[model samples]
Target: MPIEILMPALSPTMEEGTLAKWLVKEGDTVQSGDLLAEIETDKATMEFEAVDEGVIGKITVAEGTEGVKVNDVIAILLADGETADDIGGADAKPAPASSNAAPAEPSEATEPAAGYGRSGSAAQEDKPAAPAAGSKNGERIFASPLARRIAADKGLDLANITGSGPRGRIVKADVENVTAQPATAKAEAAAPAAKADAPKGSAMATGPSTDVILKTYEGRPFEEVKLDGMRKTVAARLTEAKQTVPHFYLRRDIQLDALMKFRSQLNTQLEARGVKLSVNDFIIKACALALQQVPEANAVWANDRTLRFEKSDVAVAVAIEGGLFTPVLKDAEMKSLSALSSEMKDLASRARDRKLAPHEYQGGSFAISNLGMFGIDNFDAIINPPHSAILAVGAGVKKPIVGKDGELSVGMVMSVTLSVDHRVIDGALGANLLAAIKDNLENPMTMLA
Candidate 1:
């Protein structure tokens, strides 16, 4: 039997996905571990792998087709020589499977996404730049057959005529309403009588050459290519996350002077053992240990329950070319510092290049969005959903602190803010969690222990 390849839900918040690219196309033979396609989930344009060995029969979903719901069939894997039409029924509909889903009613939490039922349009502002002159036709504009007939009957060239369809394909109404005069006017079109009344330089003034002039000494023109799939996904998701997550800021400055000294001594001693410790790695270990101490804050906001995850899947937010992605360091509480650092290095490198598989980028019990390297003083982060809170780390700065002897001493202090989902955790609970993390960071020995 042919297997239906459903769009795998990458994140819990991912209700639908856009088919970014197909690593394997129709008639291609794929092994069980082969890459099948790249899916643009809410968070990342992650590589989806094949789970079953078979010949790729039909591609139910085309790349760039967005708003395809979860579990919706995007492709088919069949036995040798089977065609796609033979597997998935010929009656199958396209992206945004036909459903009785009504327009979503606005509520306090949902009003932000009004008119977008599950079947609503995928964010199109995130689409790649419009094709360069003479590029291949992207999603053909949607037009009714009647409209096509009307355009044909009217001798209206669809090419010159602009489309008013969903993706900008010419429709019947568009053909009827265009300002182009009839071909009969071609005789009188450029006649002197017509030219006398025409506004001087009107067409030239509104012409398209003026946007950005790029001409070479040799007379070659230049056109800049656009943001790739990874970049577009990064922009849309991060923007939506920051805007909709209802963020409230919290900042705590910590004395990291002792912590830094300890790390310096620690990295030197372990240098020969191939375990070099950075202060941030130590901070991650500290955060992991602290999470174990206060598991309540590690819960996700569910319908009626604050869902507490049992594992310590620590999502370390890493930055890449166009945006940021957080590939989780799973079971951080169980891994040694070296193990954690090694795993993080491998994942971070791949994530930055958009080379990570869906599994590597998915699932986290908690999150850490660190901007310490960029020298950001402090910032609040959105809770990458299904994970209740995210810890934002700022740069460590030298500041005066009261010594045990009541004398002023210079110390290194790093600021951190934990952005918690109000529905999942309370403010006091988040504060306690931050205090525990601070303690672990202050006592470097405990993080190692």
Candidate 2:
């Protein structure tokens, strides 16, 4: 029996990916649990593992094949004792048993994603997956489904590869041995050209075609940069957000003197533990508290109705090269300033390395985009869909102001603009949310309460 190995879906939203590398070659013996290949998704380059044992019969797709659609056969595997001559009828073009499943729609039975769905989780499982390929003659291949899939993907000749499993069964561990890394130089060089030929999600949103744009500026001193997967996603999503989401803005300024003092004291006290608190950490806590104080403003637009959460799952924007990541700090209201700060540092570091899983950056009712580090004074951020609001924080500037005693004094004032989805939060609710956040920062002690 010959098994056709198809490209696996690495994420819930992944439609295609680059077959970054192949760890095994044709005629290589494989077992279940072997490392097979490295798949490069939009988020990260992930290691692909084998599930069934078999011999790689043929390699249909070469390494560095980009935009390879999910379920497309990349290779073929031959069953043990069955020579390649017996694989005559193995058709890679046969449609999946269930053809009704749409590429964009996610199925309910969520499987553990391999690379980018969740860090340290199993690979995403699909239903009706090839289970130890069998021939039309009823001869069974004693290989694990996953192993068979891997062999098929690498086009290993099953008859030639020795299986090291129970009763000589093949497993994943026998196939995958190479470390996962970026694609080869050829793939890297071809990326720009690939992006130019790729289809846009929306013709209008994507604007002019690359060819047309290049033609308009022909003979000019200009460089045509390629759009990576992350950039494309960000562009499409943000455009959709601005066009579909009815956004409203709420602006406010908070005196950061007390918060600054509180952060300094906490950092000094926690210095022995190597934990330093940043003003942004305090801001995260304040927003989390505000969500609890003003529960109505914590709601998110779910198309049909507003969905409110008891705990705050705060998404903080961490800018990275090409794009950015909004890693969520789940249950932020319960974490201490030091804990939040520590966890945020970890997420941000991984985000910059493109190591964060989909779940790490996926869900949140509210978001914070702080550009203070860049010396930005004030800015409005576009609302990420499904979330009701996003807070754009600016740098704190020292300015002279009238004190309570009517005397002149200098205070640190930080500006924040909350972009709210009008469909979810009314003006009064938004105002209350901002006020609560302001109060928490102004009195820093109240957050502890």
Candidate 3:
């Protein structure tokens, strides 16, 4: 049988991606683990691998084709003894562009679709089957070989496990973490409750239509700049964040004279080791420790509950072309200043290049967005959801400050605004979190302890 190779979902949030390039062409013999294509998702560009060994009978989706949806047939492969003729009427069509239509629903085909690793064996048909209630319309469950093996050993049902891998494919991590009970049961029970609790009506205005906007500027000459996946995702996510998240802002100004002096000393000593730390590094470390100090504030809203973390996972916003990436620095409180600086630099560089993996830019309870280097005085940041708060750091400038002696003196002062999700953090907790950050920055040497 000619197996259909569907476009893989590279990330959890990826609905569609650009088929940047094809590594193999029709008639090329490919084996498992061979690189098949470079897919550009909203977050990054990743290489897709061939999961089944076969001859590339046809390529349905061409290189440079954008907006290929998940589970849409991208190519066709011929198994042993099968030729291109076997693909006769089975010519899979390219998925419709996401903007124009939704992905086609699964059909009632008895044979499962050939996914990542499965060959769709019928020998197991006689074996006792797990509940197919949660299965995606009897569609094939994509899973890594290791995940399948682990699931078998643990007596876990693959259909019940929600894959976190590309296109929701089950991977080793998914299987290892899954409980003995069927996760689908819980999900089914929660779905209606979640839907009912969701706020009614539209949370945000759609604004004027594109046609209306164009008519309004009929006389003006303009070049239409199409939004790429990254820009579009950013716009959608931030818009939703602003609309849904109940945000409260907490402002603070911290004197950096002591920190400046300490940083200078440290830089001079570490110059031989090629380790130079920036103010942002200190800010990251300070916020991390502050999360630990004000532990009550280090939590995220999970619809029905609050998830608090023992360690601070800090996400720092890195501005890339067209959009930004908030690559997370996990367990920031445990890392040294130099370590954080090095990791931040690496993450930022990769983020700019669109080379970071999805996990690198996801899952942090708090975030820091510093426009200090750009000389921005102060700004309020939007809270990225699931995150309790985000701290917006502004540039440090020389300002007259009244000391404890009531005498005015010039000191470097940096303004910051902590945007809190009122659902997860109260006013007092947000204040405490901001105060801890300020104290940590003011007493920089204590962070080393």
Candidate 4:
């Protein structure tokens, strides 16, 4: 039978994606792998593939459409022996009995939806078959409760084991997680078998619902905006994360005089190359390097287990229209200052323009949020799920310090607060990571080395 193509979630932070364009028109013959449509999620425009072999019987969603949910049917497919009338009888993901089922994808369509971070790595031979549970028989659970429902409606089972949520229960952690998994893709090929072996609520699917508060722009008496697509998703997930997780904060002050001096010297030569580096970029690299020394802090708290990562993908939070986003700087320790600065500019600029692609803002091992540019002294951050910790950075200030000889000295002061999930990250582990970051920042040269 002809299968339906969906409005794919292109990024993890996405709730609903815009039906940016349709690559094929109605009644067009399409193969299983053909490009069917392009979806605009919060991060970027992504191409959707035909999930099943079929003749395009009808297109339900038109191009330039907004707020299309991921799994709702976008088109009707015809089978080899079936005519257009038979398309309605073909077995669908849920049931084919409902003729009134909406032809368009689901309606969580907010602005743009983002997919989770994903890898093409092979699923562990030991951990296959998780997908079966998310089918008609079992339900899906992920790093967070929302990711769970999103995965379920999209027909993804947390059992297949490629996880983007904190413990990888297949939350809205990766856009690829929304796609038909690979035969050998971490969760796709083995989902059936994995479903039997999968544990219940392994993704920590249970959490308290969050409360949302409305706010207005600067200097306005009051501004309350309506919650739609991405805004609503952010409110819901962050609320659940805060209400359930036992979050604790650890604040530290680092001397940035050395780092500032270093930047001055670097910028002199860098200016000739048309590149300018910021303190935030240095912080990004420093945090990435610190993760190597403190992997325990770089883990997710999954159902009584801690999942640690080897490389640090730092999510740099950026402000966008009507909301905020964290566009990841993958593998920060591996990139040069110029490269990091250049990419940050690109991502931030695109975020402002609402043009980032899915891969840009998917899940990261850790995240850093800076408000120093706005002259904010300091603040604590909320824990982005699955990530054990988040670093909140504040403005650097001019301060005085006592030198070794007891003479007055000028130094640059910066404050950072690490928001930790006590379940996964211990106080000592978070301290160690924070100290490591301070050492790198105060020294400033070690990060480059």
Report, for every candidate in turn, its global Cα lDDT versus the true structure.
0.66, 0.74, 0.81, 0.68
Candidate 4 residue 88 Cα shift, in angstroms, is: 8.2
Off by over 4 Å in 3: 92-110, 114-205
- Residue-level lDDT of model 3, residues 169-253, one tens digit each, is 6767787877754567546644644553442222223677678989999999999998888877777778889888999999989
Q: Compute the lDDT of residue 389 as modeled in candidate 4.
A: 84
> Candidate 4 residues 110-165, lDDT tens each?
11112211111121111121222233222333333344445555555455446543
Q: After superposition, how far is residue 124 of candidate 1 from its true place, in Å?
A: 30
Give one clash count per candidate, in the order shown: 1, 31, 0, 35
Candidate 1 weakest ten by summed lDDT: 110-119
> Which order, best to worst by lDDT?
3, 2, 4, 1
TM-scores of the models, in the order given: 0.58, 0.73, 0.79, 0.65
Worst 10 residues of 4 by lDDT: 118-127
TM-score, candidate number 4: 0.65
Identify the superior model by TM-score, candidate 1 or candidate 2. 2
Q: After superposition, how far is residue 168 of candidate 1 from its true place, in Å?
A: 36
> Candidate 2, which ten residues in sequence have the lowest lDDT sum?
114-123
